[model samples]
Target: MARPPLRNDLIEEITTRVLDGRLAAGARVNEVHLARELSVSRTPLREALIGLAGRGLLTAEPGRGFLVPPFDPDEARRLYTLLAELEALALRWTSPLELAGLPDAVDAVADEMVAALERGADLSEVDDRWHALLLSRCPNPHLLRLIEQTKPLLKRYEWCYFGGVPRAGESIGEHRRIAAALREGDLSAASAMLVRNWVSTVAFLRKDNGDQCASE
Candidate 1:
């Protein structure tokens, strides 16, 4: 197969497994196994691994190749705190900027979330897409890049963290509240909401897991 297509397919498979928590945090990975499972050669698998390491989705050791990055509770909390401040800043800064067509773009995520929950679905795709879209609205490329790095790392323990949902309808409530705040140019409330939402999200996700880490 062509390098580009083969690379894409392998990346998709790897991403799906990771997001689904099938590839657990700190889990060992085997290139040969991945190659066989993906029905591709090691060359493409190696290339995908290289790119993923650069993306901070995996830790690339000199001899270890690719390992699921460690899931440290303290580290995660610190990262979440940083993200909250960053998001607060982003929300404040992003409030006045006019996004002519952004309302529809964001509402699409809300729509998907509602539809997914109605069907008793995972809604991970809806969640991730909404996250990326909202983060992209931040003016600084560096801020966006920082969030991009953080999200993938947190996704490993995501399932064990969130596990399941009771009233999935609540997912869209924040979406509506945030959107309404953004529409009214209420930067202060929006910023506080961003901080509160993410800070609570980390605690909510960690509640059931009880900080399942070696250090803890």
Candidate 2:
């Protein structure tokens, strides 16, 4: 079963705050203040904090409650690496027939992403939809769950490095190429593109962070 709507909404709201740095890393969450600010109650707010903790966005202490975890660039790169590997596994396990009918959904989401980019609007939700559709052909529930688990951490890196940048335009082209490859039943090509997409994302983030490993 899905989480309650209030809990889910609180979770998303808190996540956005964390990703965009409104809730800075290492900052302690004042439950009362946050609940009043968000117009939510303690129960759902606590549930949201617990959910975020599970997603690696928050550290929950027995007496101190929750605090945003410090963003570690190396750890972010490692998470992206893991995400790429799991997504590649999904592509490998998905047969051509499983994806023959899914390109339309992927393309539609890509179109929305493009529109959002052109309008200088937030593309996070559309970007999520695009990737979710791209991997919908994968039949492994565990792989899917793992992919979902890494998204919050990945999005924090994205917000830190890619926000207000034109990265989405290039990403749309990559998305199209992957979708086209999948439509042609070229699993290898599609999987390669998916991995490249994620690897390139890590590279870009590293460069933005001025990491020595960016050249590596």
Candidate 3:
């Protein structure tokens, strides 16, 4: 229960900014400003940026320090597909006993998503919670860590995807179906539903964005 090292904390903090669109795609990260704002020395902040760059959450240029990568629909498609497989594998690897109560837990998180939507709140946090719950029983730490690392790459797009309240509501329905599959003790069906959820998002983004590439 101890706190993570300051470097890890800094990485999460910066990743959150990127996810929420505060850092924004294609914008150069101002190391001095961030270090000052976070009340940390430049050394640790730089290290964190380097780590994020290594993780594909940030880009490192020869002389430009760190930059937020622009949102590329093709890249998003690839990441979404990769994440879908990873998550499905995680679900399959999870012990059946550990998943016995997962359907109810997932449904409860879906309820939270419903409440968030009803009040015009963002669904991203609740959505994240639901996925984390779905895979919480997976015994493979390495797979879980890979999923964790890959998710942020698509979060900015997800934030935009869920910005449409109607789309967010549709996602809730998808979650329910996945939960239902779990309730029926159908892990294969549940995994398929989960993958469909991700696939549908990718299709939606492609249609929504069309030929317009995000500004870099």
Candidate 4:
């Protein structure tokens, strides 16, 4: 059987499964069963699990293997807070020339997202593309890595609340503002909007999830 490259494909598949709620949070990762189900061997599956554990999606337990970390509102807040800061920093680090050039690409992504929302397609993938475009000018590899690490975790909350594109109209308007700021080479404005995008989502989750926010 052909094994998809574990570093990228496997990890992405597992992350999708987790995000889609197929691999429930706090559920134990059964490597044997998962490997069999995926038609791969144990080694690659274990490697993928370890990669996820390192990314904070799964927690390691001695002897018992990896388990999905329980959702904690405090921890979610901290992660989202850090994510906002890191993304803002990335925008600051990006070059003005590059930022000025992103409008067309950003518009394309936003258009696709809007179309997808109307079609009831996967909004997460569209959202990822939009955010990725915003960070396209960031030169620091380490900072980009940190941003990637936080994305999947934040995505869990995003899925819980937005279900891909519930707030599509408002979100499209926000994207336009961010893209316009970037086109004008206004890094400070762009950075603020980037932070607002995430922090606002956290707020939305808090408002909608209510008493269940902590458990989610």
Candidate 5:
């Protein structure tokens, strides 16, 4: 029999499912089906589920096992606010010398996002790469780790936001502006733009939800 997947690997696999909407929000995690599909026994799978719950990615209730948490606009707002401040602070901490070459690198990723938008492709991954490059020079490992851990919670909402072609176009423009600010050696401007980038996403998601509610 195939050996059970390692803990980290199992966590990653389940996380992917959650992020991609394969498991879906507010869905109960079927431990049996998941174990059988993953070719692992229930024991290891349950352990992974409990771990995910601890990470706030899943909810554990009495006799309910594990469940994918429902998407909440309030939660998204709080997360986006937290991420914006964290990333902006990271930009502040990045040294001038480290950011010297960032503009060109960031522009390249922005161009890719533009091309993806033209072809009706997903821009979320490229957008993420741009943000990663923007903050690549941050010296604090702990701050970076906090950013990394907080980002997964917002990925599903980002996927929704990027699904709209116009929204993706707007994001590309915002990215270009940030890069332009960096090109001029203006870290303050770049940091402000970075925060605005995230804030706009929250606003868009909120408006989109409102529009949906009105239509319904």
Candidate 6:
């Protein structure tokens, strides 16, 4: 089957599954296997693999098929830190770009998240969509690319935390705080919120998710 666009949504879905340990890291994902798993065909799966490889979520080796890239603590921290800097810069250094349409975009996703929380909904999809909206508004291409490259990796962690692994919901309030800061155009608050959110979540997951690398 043909997959359309290899869009962020599809890639996020696959990345989430793999990261949440649902697919198992280092597991194979050939065209046929993923096609069967995803209910799509080889073409779309190939496109997805290419997209993920570019994002660093999957590695494609010569003469070998695609496999889930092992989690690297340093790489993960660097990617998240880079994202934090880019996002904080976008919030701080940009000359007060009027967030004319941002609140609506933010609210839409936040509302979905709120509902998920209300129903004790699984939050991975909501997390993916919310971050997608938050990052897409960034004004710089370099920043956007940084975000794009990190989304899959972050999505993996988010999926692990939000998937059936049963993580606590402490970050929920932090996300709300970031939304409030963005709404109010409080760069300091937004930056602080992002840093705190990233750091705290990373701390929470470090216990059993992977090796406790020197980075954290």
Question: Which number leads on lDDT?
Answer: 3
* Pairs that collide, model 2: none
The per-candidate count of clashes, in order, stands at 0, 0, 0, 0, 0, 1
What is the alpha-carbon lDDT for the whole of candidate 2? 0.80
Q: Which lDDT tens digits does candidate 4 get at residues 52-153? A: 888889889998898877667666667778898998999899888778789889988999988887887766678788888889789999999989988888
RMSD of each: 3.8, 4.9, 3.2, 2.8, 2.7, 5.3
Between candidates 2 and 3, the one scoring higher on lDDT is: 3
The runs of at least 3 residues in candidate 3 whose Cα sits more than 4 Å from the true structure, single-residue gaps closed, are: 1-5, 206-213
lDDT of candidate 2 over 1-216, digit per residue (tens): 554458878888898898777887778999999988887778889988998898888999889999987767888778878888888889889877888988778998888988888888888788888878778878899889888878887776665465245566777888999889988888899888988887777656645463432222
**How far in Å is the alpha carbon of 23 misplaced in model 6?**
4.9
lDDT of each: 0.68, 0.80, 0.87, 0.79, 0.84, 0.65
lDDT of 1 by residue, 1-216 (tens): 444446767766787676665675677778888777777778888888887878777778887778877667666666668777876776555636653335567778889888888888888778778766776666788777677666666665455456345434555777767767767767677567767666666655554364565322
> Clashing pairs in model 6?
1-41
**Could you give candidate 6's per-residue lDDT for residues 1-216 as a string of tens digits?**
565544656687777677667666666665676677667667767887788887778888877888776656556666667776666666554454654356567667767777787787677678767666666655688777776666667655443232232333566667777877777877688778877766665554454555532122
The C-alpha TM-scores of every prediction are 0.72, 0.78, 0.88, 0.84, 0.89, 0.65
Model 1, which residues run further than 4 Å from truth?
1-12, 39-44, 95-112, 135-139, 163-171, 206-208, 211-216
- Candidate 6 residue spans exceeding 4 A from truth: 1-23, 31-51, 93-97, 100-112, 162-169, 182-185, 211-216
RMSD of 1: 3.8
Residue 194 in candidate 1 has what lDDT? 65
How many steric clashes does model 1 contain?
0
Task: Please say which candidate is ahead in TM-score: 3 or 6.
Answer: 3
